[model samples]
Target chain A: MTDISQSAAVPGTAPQRPAATLSARLARWLPRLVMAPSFLVVLIGVYLFIAWTLWISLSSSAMLPRYDFVGLEQYVRLWNTPRWHTAVINLFLFTGLFLAVTIALGLLMAILLDQNIRAEGVLRTVYLYPMALSFIVTGTAWKWVLNPELGVEKVVQSWGWDTFAFDWITRPETAIYCVVIAAVWQSTGFAMAIFLAGLRGIDSSIIKAAQIEGASLPRIYASIIVPLLRPAFLSVIVLLSYISIKSFDLVLALTNAGPGGSTEMPSTFMFAYTFQRNQMGVGAASAIMMLMTVAAIIIPYLYSELREDTHGH
Target chain B: MATLDINRVRKAYGNLEVLKEVNISVGDGEFLVLLGPSGCGKSTLLNIIAGLEDITGGEVLIGNRVVNDLPPKDRDIAMVFQSYALYPTMTVRQNIEFGMKIRGIPAEERAKATNAAAEMLQMTGLLDRKPSQLSGGQRQRVAMGRAIVRHPDLFLFDEPLSNLDAKLRVDMRTEIKRLHQRLGTTIVYVTHDQIEAMTLATKVAVMKGGVVQHFGPPQEVYDRPANTYVARFVGSPAMNIIPGWLLASDGVPTVAFDTPQGEAVVRGVPLSAETAHRFAGRDVLVGIRPEHFGLDPSGTVPVGVDVVEPTGPDTLIVFAAGGTEVVARLEPFDAQVGRQERFSVKAEKVVLFDPATETRLD
Candidate 1:
């Protein structure tokens, strides 16, 4: 009887050992298995494409992508083009104005909404409604409104203000400003939402304390409240910079790089060169330059933010 | 320093009245504490005095000036918030000097005042650090330093020590008391902590449900609480209120109650002659502090000890007495559980209250 029982137990224990090890192995591999598809997709779709673009920027790839090494010739050509110069300068101008006006107007709106006001929810929704629309939609809607004969100028003239002259879109020197206006209108509400969240996170007693300290309301906001919103300001700037760089759709729909190419941006210039003008080499070079500019701004921010997280601060 | 007077101040939010004609007065350099549980309108009253909230009715006077229409800045008061609301982006030095700078004081004077306040708070080393760099107690000191630099006529503290850890809270309490002694500024402080009120206030206003239940010196509020609510709310291991009969025979007032061991009577309960005569043979609530019960072998009351909790300073023994469980705070090892022990009530300290009104009998 003892011999029979021992024999049966040995087979049972042998099978159980392998089954346990198999299940443990499956458990360890399951998460990686589930994540592998997305990981591979991103690796190929983003990083691989970036590397290909870098290679093409360094090569003499024209309309057909001929892979012949032509070390910086496309870059030289890109710099010499006056249209590219206009695109670059326009980018800087649009980015600066868009950031400044959007932040100022957004912060103002957030502060006004924070005064324990009635109907705040409805007002907030009204301000934020534009952000839900696509930039193309915003651009098209603004295009109609900015047209001198069809929109604001005509309406004002119809209302008997015949010399209103609100036609910046028609002037080459001021056309970029019109793009800046449309872009600011599209993004200011997003910045306001971020600022509102940051404002809500503050200890309300600080304002009360400042009030008791004999500081005027404007002084309190300028010195104490705004200074405390440094992190919020950094977040807003980074997000707005990202938005300004990739603002191809809005510019395309609103100005289409029109009025002597005054409102042309890097993104628009790159698209016109590569796809329309058959200068893919110069387009690739411009794309690389745009990437470098963004990296210059974002890398340092990401490094500091990640370092703060690691230090548990 | 200045006197603060709130006369018939009423605060209402639409139809819900938070403060109902509340009145309080504090003399120059006096520390007054508004003590109550949350939603008791103590903090609201403090805000009304600070001009941080609008008064639905009545008047608030500071230094004999009616500040009904004055903003908080013109009220000539400085406040310390419970969260120690130091400007997070500013250094301690800058925070202390900000008010002076806003008032357009000379730079030299601002620096001098900042340095003096920092040194007085013993945080000179921390003057260059932002609020996030400091610990809770250090932040509290910085908040006080900011208030101190103003040198306002009055100070308001809205539960300033409620955020600290237990040990740090005790330490900061002492620090605040020391500052008050050194500065001698009239202060109106709000807190839900009875111990804080007892230790720090010259006068304490114990509030409940928007009414001032008792307003007097700390000892008076402790010894002679105005009502049963004040009695129960003012003490830890709150005063035991047992139901019993007030027997007045031959002009001597005694209390009679039923215990598990049978009848128990406490003789010579001190009361006014009229109160004793009128409440004779009527139901009354006997208010007895935990420490008033003593272990005596020949005492009249017998209680069956149910639980023994030996704290470091004294042991708390819960027993069945007067048809309810009563806790007696006594020296450690005074009695054992599951034993019948006789305890005596301190006659003079014992108080009687009418059962219906819950008010002290004389």
Candidate 2:
């Protein structure tokens, strides 16, 4: 017979041991049995997927996955390419313009709506309808309005002003501004929605306190209302940045990197190289670089913001 | 610094009338408390005076100027809200200095005023802390300090102490009373708690259902209430009101009620001859405060005790009297649950009201 103390003895109690217990074995294995599946899935699915992408970025495979390592050649070649460089520049330009214009216009619209206006429901619907539309629809509509030879230029010339030239969409130097205008048109409604929520959450008592403190309406908004809205500002900035980074469909339909690749963004660049050019190694490397760039800029700011949110002022 | 005259003011929100023909004139340097339950339009009246809410039809005179059209900033007043309403992101110093800075006060004076207000509130150590970092009581102090530093003509408070814990509320009440004594500023404060109103206000306005039922000194409002509502709303645990009939046949004027304490007669009131002649045998409400009830077994009015609650200093005896529920404050030694007891109502303190109008008959 097996010794009973081997399985069930309390190690620190005394010399005499109890008999082996079924409960002890069940207790040790219960938690592991419950947790093992989820842990294995995270390890094999998510972690391995990212690891495989990273490995592919470091290799020289095309179309399908292969294992011939090239040791940083893909990254070096990526930096030297003009299209990749132009995509990086356009990303910055689009993000900057998108953030500034959206927030400014959103704040204005939010303030106007807060004034106990009539037809408030109708006004909010009109301002917020753009967010409900798909990017494909938004891009198609703007492509018509922004087409230099067909849309605005044709209409203006018919008005008998031969000197009037609305040709920004056809010019290399000015095509990026067209993209920004359409981008703002598509997303300013979202900014307005966020800011409306934030402004509504402010206490009316504070507005009263400011007025009693001898603050005019302009001063009150500048000093008290805006300062209290920093969290809202940070949230809008992060959200608008995320949208600007993967901005593909609008660029593809409206500009198609026209006027000599002036509007090619990172998402468009990644799609072109991977599917059209069939350079999977270079595409994966570009995707990895974009991910790293976003993480490097956003993670630290989000870390501090979340910590402050949980820990408080 | 200023006298606020609210002359015959009425407020109506589309057809739901809120304040009905209210009028009051607050003298210079007086602390006036508007005491009422929620939905009584006390806060709405306060906001009207601050120029934050428009009165349907009335005139507001601050000092000598009619300020109905002036905005809140131009009204020369400061208000402390129940929520503190401090700018959550600004430091305490910045919050106190905000109004002064906007008014274009020089930096030196702004600093001096902030320091003086902070020192007075005992918040010197917390001047650098944001409002979110302060405890509830400390935040209350900061809110008050924000008002005091402005040196405005009038100060308004909207239930400023209701958010604090009980002990802290009492402490802040005393602090506010002392601050009023020191500052000597004209104030209009609103509160639902009668005790706070009594302790803080030089004059108390008791409101009900959007009308001022009574406005007088605290003792006058308590001792000689205008009507049944004033008598009941101005006291803690309220005055016991019993239904009875006014007897005017004999030379003496008295009220008669059949109580479990047996037949009780309250005398010694000089009734108006008009009321006496009109209500010869009409029903009336007899009001008596709890402290006036005595627990003498051989007294003229006899009652049976139901429950005795000891509250450290005084004991409360809930007894059946005059065919209605009556609570009497008795000495701890004189109260026992389920005991045979007799209670006497102080005859002079008995108040009579016409049952139909709920108005004082005297």
Candidate 3:
């Protein structure tokens, strides 16, 4: 109360009043100002690099940077390349398989854990621990396990089952599915954790009301529980799709875009052109295309979810 | 068409007993209310009858069929919980039709039942709206409609009006009573509100410490309580219990005590020899309802009024008499604060209980 009086008196007549207001303004703005330098530095670097890539793409840049300009010639060359088309087709194959498997596996795991089973804590830790590991580690572990000669095939031969052949990692047609399996194993745990929290947030009284009405458990879950979990499912789908589109390290570590580039995703293609082949122009174009694709898919879904949340309440 | 009987029901949690040997039999088409204060095990007893809770040692018979082993679904009882428990995802129509739909009722009949219930509850226009979209009183009506639509063997209400505001609670209480009257269904209702118990209950069972202290018609339980607990619990402004001494002198029984101004006498019959042996010439408690005390300044009972609470209908005067703080409900125009007023109580209206046992002497 005394402080209120003193502050009112001080603000009423003082030369330092303007300075005090100034200090308050500076206090609010200082963090953004301090954080601007690092971000601004990255922004400038990216601008120069992108301009340089655009300039080189117009020219016949080979293995190193060139400054000659030839409009749309390199774009025409990129369109004609069969490997570029293969990479685009393979991108969809890898992402589609990864998304489907991860969502299915996550929902199944979430439902199992929702049951009143014993040792739930232990089971949850086991399932969610995979999310903490890097996809590089997961992919490498699966790659070795699925390798024909060194791992599965050799082990099966030692067990006297020489006819058993496990060679998906060595074949171009079947290798995309192998990468999908590893990616699902890595991301399903994360999606399950998101869904598990949503399941727990549902009111227990609603479930009891269903039971008291003589509804069988499955019918109640199918008709009531699933519909209530729609918002949660939307969030899970959006998060997993983002992860699937940007899947680079897992594909690189598992198949290395090898066995004839069967598992080549967009991010992996961007990295290969930028670092391996020094085709940074094509790589930067692919990066911008990937960003646009994600925005186009995610923004509408997020906007609808937000509108429903606000208006429904 | 069903008469529910609870036979010697006892409930315990490990070492702590929650309800003790509770026996109540509700007749066909009777509205039996389990009335008590909070934590008095009234809700627990209701839960047992609804088959929502397992009775520790007892049998519950619904229409002569022992149903203690049945689940809540199999018991043919519908309970409207205190929280309403309306599924937030379901519309008002679906919530009412849920039980019928689950029982394989035809859609045409379900719609007919739902429309009839909605019309009866005056909730016709709000059928498609979810529970979250409805007001508190509307949601409460939906919960009741869910129970009424079932036409179950018995209706169980667990303090269903406790969550509503004061005015809405009163209105809904009357509505539920009217619904019961029209349907003539046997219902077991639970509430801590003595006013609701007195107004709506065909029979009242007053419980305390998990034991049924008294069970009878509401007026009978209020006017003639079986023990000190029931007498004090069944009335608003609570009964005034004063410490006194029992006297059985010269073949006549009476209670004698001293007030701040003078000594007083109360007329009553002492309990049996085995009951009187423990309380003869010993300190006892005399219970008198607040309304029983009236102004008769020259009638011998003298007390100084300490506080006066005027609530339109009656005035509650807190006074000291017989070495105990007593509250008397007096005519609003006659009572005043901070004055020595003489009050007279009828001898026939007083209830005497032995202090050692708390059981009514006469």
TM-score of chain A, every prediction, order shown: 0.93, 0.82, 0.84
**A-chain TM-score, model 1:** 0.93
TM-score of each: 0.96, 0.91, 0.87
- Top-scoring candidate (TM-score): 1
DockQ (Cα-based) for each candidate: 0.80, 0.73, 0.50
- The C-alpha lDDT values of all candidates are 0.91, 0.86, 0.83
Candidate 2 residues A121-161, lDDT tens each? Answer: 89888888988887778878888888867788889988998
True contacts kept of 2: 0.90
lDDT of 2 by residue, B262-318 (tens): 777666555777777788777788888888877665566666778888897788888
lDDT of 1 by residue, B1-362 (tens): 99988899899999999999888898999999999999999999988888889999999999999998999999899999999989998999889998999889999999999999988999999999999999999999999999999999999999999999999999999999999999999999999999999999999999989989889999999988888899999888998888899876887789988889877788988898888888889999989999998888898888889999988899998987677778889888756779998889898898787889898888
Ranking by TM-score: 1, 2, 3
Judged by DockQ cut-offs, the docking class of candidate 1 is high
List candidate 1 stretches off by more than 4 Å: A1-20
Docking class of 2: medium
Backbone clash pairs for candidate 3 read: none
Clashing residue pairs in candidate 1, if any? Answer: none
Q: Which of the two, 2 or 3, has more TM-score?
A: 2
- Evaluated at residue A159, the lDDT of candidate 2 is 90
Candidate 1 local Cα displacement, residue B74, angstroms: 1.6
Best-performing candidate as measured by DockQ: 1
Best by lDDT: 1
